[model samples]
Target: MTTALLPPATDADLAVLREQLGRPARGVVGIAARCVCGNPTVVATSPRLPDGTPFPTFYYLTHPAATAAMSVLEADHVMRELADALAEDEDLQAAYLRAHESYLADRAAYGEVPEIEGISAGGMPTRVKCLHALAGHALAAGPGVNPIGDLALARSSWSPRRCVCAQPGAAG
Candidate 1:
């Protein structure tokens, strides 16, 4: 089942996101998750862009601080550790498999692209490729959906419980 439909994004959100990433947003459909400060943390994007290219990444992390936190985890080689955990823990593997399924189901709700039919981001159900993707899934789906995402959230400096909005260079 689709967990929950995200709230429609406001023009304010688009401006903030553009400022956060230092570029314009493409194919954004809704705000998947938001920080305590009311800034969008994760955005749900269209499976296919206006350019007609199939974009597989559905949940996109957009907050500047959250992205920086995930980047720090990636730099620390956390993906390798999570991959190892996935390999050794059957329960974890099962849960991660479920996460993969959920991700795919979520994407399918919008539209399907044959090229990305079975693929899920962050090396899901098999490996931990990108913390940003996993973290996005975690934020959008909330805690307990993705174990790795939970772990990353727990271990990282960033927390949705806290607000890191409007930092030094974040756009208005």
Candidate 2:
């Protein structure tokens, strides 16, 4: 959350994550990105979960407002429109391919999970499946890294510049 890179997860962070998820946060490695108010926007998760499942989603969006906004976009069929754009725009397709590579590299930094190799969240590099995952990737990697993610976040009701955390201590 601070400019110092991701800090290790602590008890308080876990507690807040549990509250945010309505279940315990599993295999969280660090806070990948934070909201403007310092609440966690994306938490970097382990490639392999505690239950021995190979989890592919390394950057998990935990902020309630951000998730909700992405949900709204999904509800409005924004992914279909984005997929159409990906089909029509070669530049966007190229950028999204790069983003896919970046996501694989980032996840590999944690550990390897062969089951999920070459796979990134939100159906990246091909189609727009989930804006929440793309937005999480965007927030974690910063702008211009994930083009569709940036577009989704820009078009969404949520803003990284805003703090919509339900409570002061609530973060993932």
Candidate 3:
């Protein structure tokens, strides 16, 4: 199922996001995905920031546990493995290109930014640069859209199905 954008962020939601990110979330359009405990997970950011900066990453992952999981995978050099798999699989390459197109379309819905035109985050349509960005897109867009993101999620120790937001020292 596609994860619809939540209603406009409330003051409380903003506060949680601040804590989750350890800073103010700039140009957040809405909460794209939420934790089971109702905390913001994936945030939909504007194509451009409030300060005239072209921000290409529309689906920003904010969940601390999820972010950490992606980081761990990166540290383990899983991106190299994924990249190799992509090179060997024609269907996967096609799906990844589709994912790149979908990402561009989703960002375009917010606004157009010339500086970031045709650029989707995570080195999409070509390379696996950032698993966090890919996973963010996966969580926001739902399964079957981004196969690489889904694969990373499958390999990660964290699961969005469970709520870790309330756990002590979770912080995000």
Q: Best candidate, lDDT-wise?
A: 3
Per-residue lDDT of candidate 3, residues 71-167 (tens digit): 9999999999999999899999999999998888888878888999899989899899999999999998989999999999999999989999977
| Position 164, candidate 1: lDDT | 55
- What are the models' TM-scores? 0.95, 0.92, 0.95
For candidate 1, lDDT tens digit of each residue in 24-90? 8898889888898788889898888889989888999998888899999999998888899899999
Candidate with more favorable, higher lDDT: 1 or 3: 3
Q: Write the per-residue lDDT of candidate 2 for residues 20-100, one digit (tens) a residue.
A: 888998999998888887767789999999999999998899988889889999999999999999999999999999999
Report the Cα lDDT for candidate 1.
0.87
User: How much lDDT does candidate 2 score?
Assistant: 0.87
Q: Candidate 1: where is the Cα deviation over 4 Å? A: 1-3
Local error of candidate 2 at residue 5 (angstroms)? 7.7
